[model samples]
Target chain A: MPPKMNIEPEPGDQTPEVGAATDVAPLGRDHGKPAHELTAEEDADGTDWGRVAGESEFKGLLASKRRFIVPATIFFVAYYFALPVLVGYAPGLMDTRVLGVNLAYLFALSQFFMAWAVAALYVRAAGGWDETARRIIERLHSSRKEK
Target chain B: MSTPLLMFLIFVGITLVITYWAARRSTGSSAYFAAGRSIKGWQNGVAVAGDYMSAASFLGIAGIIAFQGYDGFMYSVGWLVAYLTVLLVVAEPLRNAGKYTMADVLAYRLSPRPVRAMASLSTLTVSTFYMIAQMVGAGALVSLLLKDSGVTYQAAVVGVGILMIVYVVFGGMLATTWVQIVKAILLMAGTILLSVLVLAHFGFSFGNFFDAIKHVTYHAAAGKVVTQDFLQPGLRYKPPYGALDLISLGMALLFGTAGLPHILVRFYTVPDAKTARTSVVWAMAIIGVFYILTTFLGFGAATIVGRDVISKNGGTNMSAPLLAQAMGGDIFFGFISAIAFATILAVVAGLTISASTSFAHDFWTNVIHRGTERAPGEEVKVARVTAFVVGGVAILIAIVLGPTANVAFLVALAFAVAASANLPVIVLSLFWRRFNTRGAVAGLGTGLLASIVLILLSPSIMTVDPPTVTGAARHLIQSPPLFPLENPGLLSIPLGFLGAFLGTLTGREPSAEARYTELVVRANTGLGAEKATTH
Candidate 1:
């Protein structure tokens, strides 16, 4: 088993023993619990969400994410639109032969590769984001431990 | 229907049997809605692919490419890239933040009651529209496949409707997942076989296949003679407006996949956020390969078998199956027809479960009951009943509309609704910390109304042909569309985002700020996410 990461139950919350037990036991929607109550009541067991959301680590997570997703979205939209745009406005260039086929057909085929490549790249970068999130989560636990 | 009617029955029988087994294990709401969240990564992957690959994306695109050549492929390319949006923006956050429906995520920081009601409205509209499109396709395709077996279009539609309802109401998500897996396998197998046969015709050389598609002469739908230069674009849509139409279509598709409720719900079936992320990639790989081969199937049908045969038989949707008959003769035709039936069955079931889950979980439990069901099994029971009602309504719509009622355009409207109405709220709720319940409601309402109004005013609904010439009054107005575009995504999507922004700036809810932090924490890190329970 992996070594225990530094996390602790909040003051007046469930004991660490109780927390471990509930992890395996199945729980329903907590029907009696009002929707807002669950999050607000997390004061007894959960981290300081306001701090986490505002922290430099969380901001960095969002920034790095935007760096990847925003550019990725723009590039994909442009690349995909290029096919219809070129084919519609410049059929001559689109139809120009490359490797014994229409450039439009070849370009359209390349989109499959492009999509897969971009998806793979994002997945790779997301690992770092995951790491940053882990750091934030660990900080939440360690600070609670200190308290 | 045809010799394949028995094969179709056999496939249904298997699903029904699976339904019987799943029903026992799916008594609770979570199991009914999300297969108890017990589905593994790869299984959910295939299921997601199965849920997504719908008959239109498979056989329909082939027909389009067969008839419209390279232009049909423009539609296919957008579809693959669309999943990138899903991978980058929607998948994991949705899976982590949601419980059983997309509303769970969208309504997280918003006022739960009103936001959920609006979200449910958007979900139901999208589901019904998409379901109707598939039902129409199923109706047309089934009758064609079973033509020799005395099946009428009405019988085929009712049969499909009843079977899908049974699978959803009885079996719920488990039965739906298994059916999708089975259908995904069958679809890929049949496609691979057909692709191989098509390749064999050209001595197994990809070069020969490309070389030959260029010279083969065939009749277009309008009876004009056309050759492989049909491989060139502009055959379907001409310049200016045509190019604009293409751009709008790409927008709807690229954004639409990320918003589709049925597709979004599939992510919730997995174990965690990471698995949800992996499943998108899995689906992308399977769907991408299938799409590339489908284009090949269209070329084969257009070149080797000729468009005259395809259009004369049953329009473009029949291109792939006809190519199967042309290449492998009668038995292969039967086999392919059965696979097509399974494909339609799986997709409609997926749509049904998502719709019903939203009705019972969001509308009934959350909205009507104020976020609490009276009993453990009550929500699941209500969901089953909702599935029956939803299925019945879909059957009536598909039958009343009939087989020739522009299924593709209806599908486009479905995507347009999803992109404009649903996606904006979902995206803003995640990233924009200031987005409140007012913003959610405004965005959804504005997007929903704008998309519907645009479609009603658009050319798809408003035909240019005179009633006297076309032999039918397509619209009360005889002139061309006031809204020039067929798809409203180009204009409506912007309006959706604008409505959200305006609502945020105009409205105030200090409560939104406090919960926003908690939601972001859950949405990003997957801490405190709802966990799956054992059956």
Candidate 2:
């Protein structure tokens, strides 16, 4: 078995002995307590969540996430709405035959490819965010152990 | 039995067997509500696709395209593009923070009882509207397909409802997930085969296909034969209100998907936030490809089957099945009809579970009992009871409305409510530090009321139909519409955000500010997430 992690129970919360007993049980690793058994008030019992949120790493993570997500969202919403707007107001231009089909149909078809491209790009960017998140968690665990 | 009825029965039998196997494994609340968080990324992705597609995408959109030309294909685009909202904004944070339902996240940092109450109310409203449409559609399709066997619409509606309840109450989320996965696979195979046949009918050439589409000959409404360009826009959404309605509908679909209770709950069935993200990617790929192929399904029907024949055969919704009969004969028709039946059953099961989960977890356990299950396994019991009640109610309403009812508006209203009510509060709770319980309550209440009220005043309900339209098919109101747009998203979404902002300014809650730090940490880092069960 792997060595026990260094997470501490909150003062006046479950005893360490009780935690250990539940932790060794079969099935879920949530110390024998299912998610539905825990109230929302008790969700952050063991962690110093305020400190973690104030950390520079977390802020950097949020900033990078916003940087990728904000522009991507704007680009897609604008690109998608352009179809209905142009089709509604400028039917003549949209009706011009491009290759074999009309521009209206071609523009509508392009939306599927555009959505796929955006999703692929987001998936690529999210990989870096996942790595950053891993580092932040490792640091928090190590800090808890030192204390 | 006819070939189609035999094929449909086989599909139902297979799903019942899966439900029976899954019933044994679902012991606790987590297993029942979330499938024990053991679902893999790709599996959850396919299930999400299955839940999202519904009969609306598979049959309704195909019929629309076959009838309305370019305007009909817009629904396919909005539906697929909506996933980008799911992927970029909501999926990871939700998986990391919430437990079983969407209200779990709202209850995390805010006051539990008030927020959970409003959220549950909105969830139930949205689910009911969406479910009625599917149930009515199922009844209509089944009766049409099985007319030779003397099965009535009411019998088919009850059959679909009972099967949906059985899947939810007995087998729970595991069974629901597997049913969705099975349905998704069947739907994709059917779509791919039909698309290929459509291509083959055009001599395997894009030029030949477009040439036919350019000159579609059919009888117009006045019984005059006309040759028209099917690829051009403005066939269905025409003149004064059409432009604004299209834009409003676009906004609803783009934002509404991320807020859907059924779709959001699928994220919680995954092990972690990363897996959730991966699943969203898989869902996008599958949904995008399926929608793109609607180009073939819709246009192929218009060119090959002809609008005149489809109108006389089974109205608009039978375009896909009729095209199948024309292209690959009767056996293929049976196969496609069974796929459509499977599609409706899978979607209703997804909706029932999500609705009942929210009612039990958010409203009964949290709101009424102050966040405690009074008895062991009481929450699951309540959810099971709720599923039965929900399914029974849907069956009754669909039968009352009859087979020919216009329920396109109900699906549109579902999207509008989800976008306006659920999405705004979810975004604020995750991002804004000042957001409190009041803001969530206000957002949910205002968004819910605004969408419904606007829909009541909009063209969907108020327009006058010609004297030829009769019974359940006519509009609810005979007067001219007060609201021009059919969908309420253009105005209601902004009003929802405004309500939340105004409610936040009404009070200063220091505790909510303090807890925002905790919520941000858990939402981004998955620090205190529930672990996946090991077998």
Candidate 3:
């Protein structure tokens, strides 16, 4: 074995989703080789991926992502920026007393919480998204191998 | 000379050692551009944070708050929220799709030549403007720190220019990444120390700190007395267009960060999409802590250092260092000043490599060589020459423009170009299959032109304050601005998106549309993405 940098994840574990493409591992690893040495087999058998793009699962991935992202972006942009907009237009409401600090400071502090929550939520949701991408790649590889 | 200059030499020495170490690893184009995609997630996370926080964020935001009060905190809130856009949308897709430059993604489904040419133009323009701002800011800062120590501003400008160029020429991306990592560590430590000192001064009570911020008073430009109630807004925003100006500036920062060519290219340094995702989280966490502490630093300057002295010594940019001097005398001041100097140097080096890489990889080889990259090691040679030229021009411009040039406007312009020009194409080409070569060209051209023209006509350029007007502002029409708003993001971003949609409807490139399926699968799954080359 080459004394690889420990920066890499455990060899096959990183590719567990594409586990079906194990037969094509040698061809894919040829990316480190010179450009001309990259044979057509890298695109022929388990490597050709055009069929995977057209699958319904792929379209569903896009749709589901849009479903999460569209609302999240709208909510965060509106909620976070509302502090500045309201503080500009309606100063009295923001200046209303709470603790030693004013209402404006409280609202500003909440934005940090909202950002952390949203980022954590997305990372959690993306696990499922990654699984779907793996299944699509695996299915394409298995079909190509049978051929 | 003094402790600050001595400290600066030590900083240069450390980076030189790192550059010598990196020079061997950076022989091939892949290593030079993407560090062979070998950087670990956490180290890259620190480097990315370093790239994002300029001296402007560290010194500039605190100074703005010290002078302007609660309205200055708005920048912190807006800047932090902006990262969500990067994390939620841009990070993973960009890492998987791009190899060296953002042009890789933009030209993936388009005609490589014209698409790359336009992408390269936008990249050079944004990075050049940003580099000049950093150079000029360094000159201004050096003059303030070395008042009677006999170092001229021109010498300061040349020294910074030479140091940054040497790092790129000798070290390339690997050296740049490590410099950024070290700088980030130093900045975070300095900020934490300053915050702790400020809290101690207030009896370690949060209430006392807040009370002091509410009570500090400053002399307004018009000779009126302004008491800073640090929690209430509008010390800077005074009615009418104040709300509009706030929104426009907010929109630019929120969208601009994701589109920055330097920032976007950093994603390619890591090995996989998962690493890219984690990097964003780590960067935001560190960046958020720094921004939040600005409130303490700014308030400490206002109440402790006194507004009159800060403004008299070096304007708003000197508040943080002045606060350090007030807190711990001259030694702390020297340490803080050296970090400020290193901050500017690291950021400019990052900008230089990104701009040079786009020129060679995107335009010179892809456009001129017809994507062959024909001769071995040719791209690396072209990139080195371009880095030297870019650094030289920035030095000449900084020298001629002098120390006090009003170049802060250039930072806003750089952000505007990134958000308006570069961002629209990256988004559309990745998600919208019908987006064609014509649409990519149209989006880029419209965004670039719209941002430039609007900024020229806007209040920031037109309505310059009489006391500080110099260079082009002295000869320009000085009155009510043709465009009422200061930032043009609200108008230009929509125009970019509209141009893309209209161009796709008008121009038909069937081959470009046909390649969209492959681009989509490759970006989503990393099926045949470029792998890290062997050592």
Interface alpha-carbon RMSD, every candidate: 2.7, 2.5, 2.8
Q: Which candidate gets the maximum DockQ versus the true structure? A: 2
lDDT of candidate 2 vs native? 0.91
Over 4 Å off, model 2: A1-44
lDDT of 2 by residue, B122-151 (tens): 999999999999999999999998887787
Clashes of each: 2, 0, 0
Indicate the worst ten consecutive residues by lDDT in candidate 1 chain A: A35-44
**Pairs of residues clashing in candidate 1:** B1-B146, B2-B146
* Pairs of colliding residues, candidate 3: none
> Chain B alone, model 2: TM-score?
0.99
TM-score of each: 0.91, 0.94, 0.92
Off by over 4 Å in 3: A1-48, A142-147, B222-225, B464-476
Best TM-score among the predictions, by candidate number: 2
Error of 3 at A7 (Å): 30
Residue-level lDDT for B433 in candidate 1: 79
**Per-residue error at B348 for model 1, in Å?**
0.9
Q: Positional deviation of B171 in candidate 1, in angstroms? A: 0.9
lDDT of each: 0.85, 0.91, 0.85
Interface DockQ of candidate 1: 0.40
**Considering summed lDDT, which 10 consecutive residues are worst modelled in model 3 chain B?**
B468-477
